[model samples]
Target chain A: MIEVKDLVRQFKSGDRTIKPVNGVSFELGKGQLASIVGKSGSGKSTLLSLLGALDKPTSGDVVVDGVSLAGLPDGKLTEYRRRDIGFVFQQFNLIPNLSAVDNVMLPMEFADVRKSARAQRAKELLEQVQLDPEKHSRRTNRLSGGEQQRVAIARALANEPKLILADEPTGNLDEQTGEHIIELLSSLSRDHDTTILVVTHDRGLARKADRRFRLHQGQLNEDVTAGR
Target chain B: MSVLARSVGNAFRNKIRTAAVVAVLAVAIGLALSMLVANQAVGAKVQELNASVGTTLTVNPAGGQGFEGGGEPLTAAEAATAAAVPNITSVVGTKALRLRTETTTTDTADAAAGAAQPDAGGPGGQAASVTTSLTAAVDAGTLGNRNNTGSGTGTGTTNGTEPARTFTLPITATGTAAEVDSSGKALDITSGTGLGDYSAASTKALVGTTLAEKNNLKVGSTFTIAGKTYTVAGIFDAGTTFGNNAVYLTLAEAQALAETPGELSSMVVTVNSMENVDSTKTALQAALGASKADVTQGQRNLETAVSSLNSVKGISLVAYIAALATAGLIILLIMVMLVRERRREIGVLKAIGARNRTIGLQFVLEALVLVALGSVVGAAIASFASGGIASALVSSNSSTAAGATGQRGPGGGPGGPFGGATQLLTSVTASASPGVIAAGIAAVFAVAIIGALVPALLTARIRPIEVLRGE
Candidate 1:
């Protein structure tokens, strides 16, 4: 579950203050999938960052699973990310020199998982994302774009976090693969009871989420799609 | 998936960059390690030599270094001041003068044979006479188990006229046993004994090898100097003709003979170590005044040799520092580039909940790996190459120059104290052991960590959101 009220993120830009997320508020239930759509510079990513406990906002009260994210210390925020949330980026951002499986196992390593268990879990996660065992051993740089995105998704699942934040996860993939990734995320939200939020420019993907919110000029407008 | 595994994997991400940095570090650390070994080796050799011979300051009348100065000779009081100076363990003072000998063949048969010879005044009963001059001193001869008598030499002469041709012999009348020991000029006695157990006050004498052999004089044979008879008690090998013709007696006899009851021509002050030589000389000068005494340290030639060799030591030390710094710079530069290249990956890790230390640790580990490899390769190369390089750096010309200096003496006067024995160093070989290698590795590891840490700390400040935004 997530709750945000009056969140504001302002940055200094050459004597001018730019508020990317200003007085935005939202809430989403557990096991729900949601989408935040916005034009470039509309602060969708900034709000997501605040909700993910990745950055401090100028003013905010964000609660995920009853834990306040705003103003939390760095250590506790990192703990929240490590134990409760997973992130997927538009670029996939897999560690380039590492094999797909190694990339997938990275988060688990941060969690202190043993080497053998990390390897096993990474392989299973890769398989769950339809990546071949052969592909799991390939360096992320050598993988196909879709395969790299799949690896990123598998890595996101490595720690089995309660929430997944997909930042344009399918942005660089072919349309068909992007659709598949969206379905995969939706399936995880429904079956595993994991909440999911995707920030994307893809309207087709956004429409498929359980809830949709459009961000404009640092303000949020909700479009309820749950129970559709 | 482990931090070290990930770091190692990242180390080779840019093969060219990795190899370039590694190559630079290997050479830099290699040069550094080699210099370290060379400095240590040369320093050790010099220390040993210095410890063995120690140091001796020659405090002479201020004006002349040799026997040519015009200043008044040091008085007994002045010499005492020299002895009392800090670092001066013992002082031996001397008063030298030319001793001209008058000889006559007492053997009537040899005289008849000499008279029958054309070179003998054609049997005109021209009692053939020869005159030889020597510099006799009241300074004690070095004659003890303590190289307090480090290395010195003396000279005398023997005429072929068996009946007795007057040959001038340089004689030293020693005042005390310790003074004699501090002379370091004491010859190794080949026959008989040491001036009678190092201390009996007698008008007895010791003859050099050449003098003993030439006149057929044995331990009990008597010789006359200043018209006083002295029984020979020993024959000593002085290693050179100049040294082998010398003689020793009690200081009272030589002063009575020289007629200078309380004057010192020169003073030798023994010091404990070479490090103390300069200070001892300074103190003696301060005590006696600059115009009163010209202080000369023992083994001037060897000191010169070591001085020349010390330049290489200096350069190598500088090189070691520069190399270490350059290695650090190289790591810092490479890590900066690496951090730039891996900015995205760092963000991803951070977003996945990696702590600042975790990310920094990976870079530190990577830098350490490169440094570790460099140390092994550098040390291995230095172990084989340093000996030759060090030898090459130590100019053989300096050693020869030192030899020439040692070989030089008043070919006709006493060889003085330390003959050619001051040839202390020729070549030095670095004897690096496993412990040395281990120390080198430890140093390199530290250098690597410091080099990586600066950039790694920057990584800690990276914001994941900004990195993702930039992408």
Candidate 2:
């Protein structure tokens, strides 16, 4: 579950203050597969970052799983991100030097998972994401765009966080791979009872989300629909 | 992965960079280790030498350190006063004299030939034609104490039969046999024997083999000096040219020949221990009253040895410090570059719940790995090279000090300049001891911790949000 009450994030650009996510408010029930769709300047990623506790808001508040992220110290925010939300990036920002299995084990390592348990969980998660066992030892750079994205998803799921915040997870993949990635993300709502929030500019990808929110000029408009 | 394993694994992420940093650090640290080993070795040698030769004091007559500068000779009575000083173990006195020879021959036919050469106060031959010039340092007590034990008699008093004139050599010669013993230092007897128990009235003498050969004299042969006739009791081989032409006799005999009675050339006072040398010398000086004698201890040689060793040690210390500083600076430079390259990874780790301390610790761990590798190599190289470097350094330093002119003889003899302290410094063997190696390892760890902290702290301040957002 997530709640946003007039969430605002501002930045100083050459003496002029600009608001990326200005006074935006929204809420989503538990186990919801959601997408925030916006153009390049629409602040969709900023909103996702706020929800993931990756950035501090200039004003207002973001609440996730009954805990507010308002005015949390940097140390606490880091902790909140670690225990609560998992993040996936558009470029599949897995550590380039690490193997696929190692990339999946990264978050679990930060969470102090035992090495054996982390390995076992990472193997299972990678398999569930459809990555071949043999390919798990391959470095992230050596993997294709589609396989890299799947490894990123496995890493996001390693800690079994209450929420998954994926920022353009399929932005660098082909259309077919993008659709496949979207399906894999959506299936998690039923398969793992996990809430997933994806930020993308593609309307087609947004259409697959169980709940959709569109952003324009730092404003949010939500659409609740039962998607097949 | 464990933090250590992961940090080690991360080191190879930039293979070229890691290898380069490690190579530079290895050389810098190796030099430092060498200096440390050398310093330890020289320091040990100095201490050992000091302990080996216990403290000694050589008390000479006033202004007798140089040649040809005659001053008031120390009196037998003043020597007695010096013996009363506390901690005085043994006080040996010597009196040297250059005497003119008178005709002396056991053979009647040769005696008749020598009678023509004139006796004492006979004629003004200027330098005494046919007169043998003999220099003798008669012991008022013993020659070298090799055969003599403490006499339990009055200080500077002869342990032998009383000489005609009351004089003294500081040595307390109270032994049974009168034949030569292997103990006499400055001179070695080649044949015959040392003096028999002779009195002030006895005419016995000890002659060097060189003088004996020149004069064709043997034990039982007779020689006369300054109108006194003497039989050769022993023949000795003085190793140096200075000692070769000399003879030894009872203090009374030598004093009678030099016509200086109740006098002493010098006195050597032995303290119980080196620690007590200075105090004993000071006490003896006070006992003797002002300016009676020049109380010189083994202090110069000790000081020379210590100063030489310290000079070498100082260089080694400087090198060690320089090496540590350079290594630290190099490590800091490399670590900064490495942290800058890994700023993104730091952000990712933070995003994954790595606390700032955790991230900083990871970088520091990586630095330790590098340091470990470099330190091991450095220590190995230093092990091979430290000893020779230390020996050469100490030898050079001590050799310079020993080469100075006007150095006193072992016992304040105005004998010659370079008499004592020549053998003080032997070749020192310096190596990397276990303690030194351990210190080097500890230093490596300290450098690693400090080197990484600066860059790691700066990296910890990087915001994951800003990094990821910019990307």
- For model 1, residues B266-375, the per-residue Cα lDDT tens digits are 66678877667877777778889987777776665556556655766786778777888888898898888889988877887899989999999999999988887788
Candidate 2: regions farther than 4 A off? A224-228, B52-56, B60-294, B395-426
TM-score of candidate 2 on Cα atoms, chains taken together: 0.70
lDDT tens readout by residue for model 2, B1-471: 667877898888878878888888888878778888887887787777565444556766665541233456666787678778899865655545433233333534334323323221111111111234332234333442332233111123333674222222121111111232212123356777666552353467787666677677889888776455778877776565445556677655554544556565666566776567667778887787656667776455565566666677788888888888888888788889878887777877777778888888888888888888889888887888777667676667656666663344556442233234434455667768889878977886787688788988988788888788854
Q: Going through the candidates in order, what is chain B's TM-score?
A: 0.57, 0.54
Error of 2 at A145 (Å): 2.0
Return the lDDT, model 2, position B437. Answer: 79
Which candidate number maximizes DockQ?
1
